[model samples]
Target: MSASPLLDQLIEALRCLPGVGQKSAQRMAYHLLERDREGGVRLAARLAEAMEKIGHCERCRDFSEVPVCPLCASPARETQLLCVVETPADRLAIELATGYRGLYFVLQGRLSPLDGIGPRELGLDLLAARLAAGDVGELIIATNPTVEGEATAHYLAQLARQHGVRPSRLAHGLPLGGELEYIDRGTLAHAFGSRSEIPS
Candidate 1:
C-alpha cells in the first residue's frame, strides 16, 4: 500500500480504464502526479464535462451534446439506407473506411440473453419506428461476426421485412491481401461458401 491514501485511490481509479491493470494504473498515476499534473487536470476537467454533457442522439443513439447528432441532421446523407452498428466506435470505423453516405442506428450492444442484453436494451423499438416511417428502403446490418451479432442481425432482418424494408448484412470473408493458406479454417470455409461470380 502507498503511504498516501489519496495516491492509492488515484491509482485504483485509473484501473477503471480498459486494459489498465494495477501496475499500469500505478504507473499512470505516478506519471500524472510527477510529470504531467497540468495534463491530468485538463483530462479530469474534460472527462467530467463529457460525462456530464455527452448524451445519446435522439435519432441514431450516437454520442452527442444535442438532441440529434450532426450526421442524422445532415441532408447529404442517404435517408433510404440505414446502417445498424453495435457501438459508436463501429460506426466511426465504417465512416472512416467506407464511402457509405447512409445514415446510421447505433445498437450500443448486441443481443446477449446471458448478459441480459435484449432488443429493448439495444433500442429496437426506435429502429422499428424509423423503419415504419417509410423513409428507409434498406436496413444494413453491420454487426460483428459473432454468435450474438448474427442473432441480432437475424432479428433485425426479420424486423426490416415486417416493415417492408430490404435487409442486408455486411459481407464477411477473407481479409484483403490475406492468403488462403494462412487463413483460419472457419474464415476459409465461409469465404469458399460465399464466393461470388466475377464481373464480366
Candidate 2:
C-alpha cells in the first residue's frame, strides 16, 4: 500500500521545482522511472554537471562555466554598450530575441528589501565600478516590468548617471508586470529596438 522509498524521494525532490505540485511531481517521477529511464539518467547527469560547473561570471555576474561568459569575451560585442538584466535567463532571452551586440551586466536578482535583497546583494557595487571605469558609454536596463524590477532599473539608472554613462530602459512592447524570460521573441525584439532613454 506504500510507495518505495526511492520513488517517494524522487517525487519529493521534483516538487522543489517552481509550479510543480505533489501530483505533478508524482506523475513526473512515474514517467521518468517507468517510461523514460534513459532520459531520466541523462537529466540527472546534466543537472549534476551544471550544478558543479556553473558559477557567476566575474565581470557580468551571469552564470558561466569560466571566469567570463562567452558573450563577454567575444570581440564582436560592443564594450561601450551594456545591458542590465535581472537574471541570466533574461539576458539569454534578450540575446536570442534582439539584434543587440552589446555587453551585459546581470544583476543576479532585483531589489526586494522585504526578502533582504538589496544593492550589495545584487552586486550593484561591481556594476558601479565597471561604469566608472569609463569603457562603457551607455546602459540599457532590460529588467522585467515588475515593481521590483522597475525599482532596480531606477537605482541602476542613478548609478549610471553618477558614473557619467547614458541610461535607457526597454520600450513599451513588453506588457506590464511581465517577466522578460516569458515574453515572445518578436515582442522582445521590438521593445529592445525601440528602447527609450532614461534621463539620468
TM-score of each: 0.95, 0.83
Model 1 misplaced regions, further than 4 Å: none
Report the error of model 2 at residue 46, Å: 1.0
lDDT of 2 by residue, 19-136 (tens): 9999999889889888999999999999999999999889999999999888899999989999999988899899899999999999888999999999999999899889988999
List the RMSD of every prediction in angstroms: 1.3, 6.7
lDDT of 1: 0.96
* TM match of model 1 to true structure: 0.95
